[model samples]
Target chain A: MSIFEIIGAVFLLIGSIFLFLGGLGIFRMPDVYNRLQAGTKATTLGGMSLILGVGFLMVETNWAWMVKAIIIVIFIAFSNPISSHALARAMYKRKRYPIITSKDENMDAYREVNENEKKEEDA
Target chain B: MRKFLVILILAVLGFYLFEAFSGLGLGFPRFEHGVKDYYLDKTVSELHVANTVTSIVVSFRGFDTLGEVTVLFLAVSALGSVLYKRRHDVGSRSILFASSGIVRSGSKLLFPAIILLGVYIFIHGHLTPGGGFQGGAIIATGFLLMLLAYENFRVSHHVLSYVESLAGIIFVVIGLLGFIDGGTFLQNFLPSGILNELFSGGVIGIIYVMVGFKVAAELTGLIYSVLHEKD
Candidate 1:
């Protein structure tokens, strides 16, 4: 095969690997937020690489078709993360999952603020 | 426990009964003799749209495009109504604009480029895989970038609504005109010029332009709603 074909093949392989990792992350992740980040980010990158590979593999006559395919890839790459972020934030607000751990120093301060607000409201 | 079991049984039975009674034929799309072949052959060349699917959607199925735009409009409205924040509420965290150099400069560079690209796609939609929907979404992204990179940015609601409504009304009027002049609702009433050139298709480019505007407006409205939810 030609060098172009080899390069395309490499991209396709790498994309598939990332896609597999995304699925693994989805299945193994403990919580909704982490799963979403893992799944969306990996799949978006995987999808782009796969499409780019396919575009590269096309011949001259099909160049326009390949370009069109790449445009779609670009569209998905931009939109997916934003949508996922929105959904995750909504879930977090709804308290859909347990917080596994907290290493931050401001946790107690946040709690104190909430307590003060409650006390003031009761007064 | 017994009541729960009975409810589950009834639900399962109801689903089964509905599926069995449903009259939908389990089959793929059927073609009438050479009709599909003829249209497929003529579409790309005649419409100057590289993607036959896009041509079919925006031109032949123009009414569907109208419905899609309306759906998006309704979605924006619904999101707005649901997510509207009370004046007293402290709202979502205010986005700080004093980020590092990379985000500030990167957005400044990327925003204009994205807008130009959106316009380019919309204008050349007839000759490309990109169409009204893609271009509209791209335009929305440009607006979104501005909103993110600059906290003070606010889209002009009056101007956006005026443009959006005008485009939608024009689309409907064109469709109505098609029915008045011809048999089909969105029939190509205008002249169909020679293939593979700008301004060649009859009513196709007009429809695409309308769709592009409508989609851009509605999506931008949706993004605005999302951002201003905590306002």
Candidate 2:
């Protein structure tokens, strides 16, 4: 109806698209770690966009709802990455190695560390 | 033969469910003039509360809330008892695995803000959509984040238990006070302040605050016990 509403609708559409992409990534990704990265990043942005769109729509009527929306956006931004990181770390600790297609420097370093520990044990 | 029999049973059940559901309207529910009207009309004038849901939860259905809180308490206690272990039994297994500096710092930074948001939600329950349960869950989530990020973080058992007991006691004492004042249980004895204001809703707000504290403490304790399980 209004310009703000139109903008809100656009944001909502973009957010929905991102969310769908996130789901697709989860389905397509090879390993647990990759899937977590895709899902977390895409969904967090998607969700925040949706909330912002709703806040825009409510700007004309109620400002309080917009404030609440902002708070939610901040919360999601803060929490999502932390959760994904925890999951990734836990998986790594449990020896759930990723399927490596090419040379990965981090994996090489991790292997070297393990070898060093084994050598120390042998001594 | 087994597959055929299973398919026949599934078809029969699906048909029955479909037929039953098809009789009911699928769209928006029809508006009715029952207790809904009474609550909408009387909530403001009688209770001086803008939120009818709060009035209903804290006043009309106070006993139900109490029962729900009791069930939650019982569930938490049961979980704690089942997961209980002696100090030595909780072996010094390093719960904190090696984590990146980003995660460690991020959790510490966000923890206080999340707790503040939870407190805000519960305190404004009478005026807002969120109340004790929602706020408590959010607070518990913050604790969960800390547990996941920090290796040696522990929620003090004594503090949680004390807060839980104190909140429960205050809630009951308030209800008893109303009864003793020759009114119904959990009746609003104090003068209902101006509507739409924070201090309004009298006993309803107070009761909700107590519920919030109890829920937050109980949930945090439950999470702690579960996370600290002996390997």
DockQ of candidate model 1? 0.12
Provide the clashing-pair count of each candidate structure: 0, 0
Q: Candidate 1 at A19: error in angstroms?
A: 4.3
Model 2: which docking level applies? medium
Model 2 lDDT tens row, B106-152: 99989899899899888888898888887888898889888877768
Can you tell me which runs of candidate 1 are displaced by over 4 Å? Answer: A18-52, A59-123, B1-61, B67-101, B124-130, B173-189
Looking at model 1, the pairs that clash are: none
DockQ of the candidate models in sequence: 0.12, 0.62
Native-to-model Cα distance after best TM-score fit, residue B169 in candidate 2, in Å: 0.5
Tens-digit lDDT string for candidate 1 (A1-119): 77767877888998999999999999998888789978999999899888888877773447775787688686776566665765664464454754546987665453455457559
**Recovery fraction of native interface contacts for candidate 1:** 0.00
Candidate 1 residue lDDT tens string, B1-231: 999999999999999988986755557565567567766877855555555766778776666877888898788778877776667875667643233334445567667768888887877677777878889899999888778766778899888889789988988888888889997787778887666666767787787878888889989988876676554
The best candidate in terms of lDDT: 2
- For this target, which candidate reaches the highest TM-score against the unseen true structure? 2
Q: After TM-score superposition, what is the CA distance of residue A67 in candidate 2 from its true location, in Å?
A: 5.1
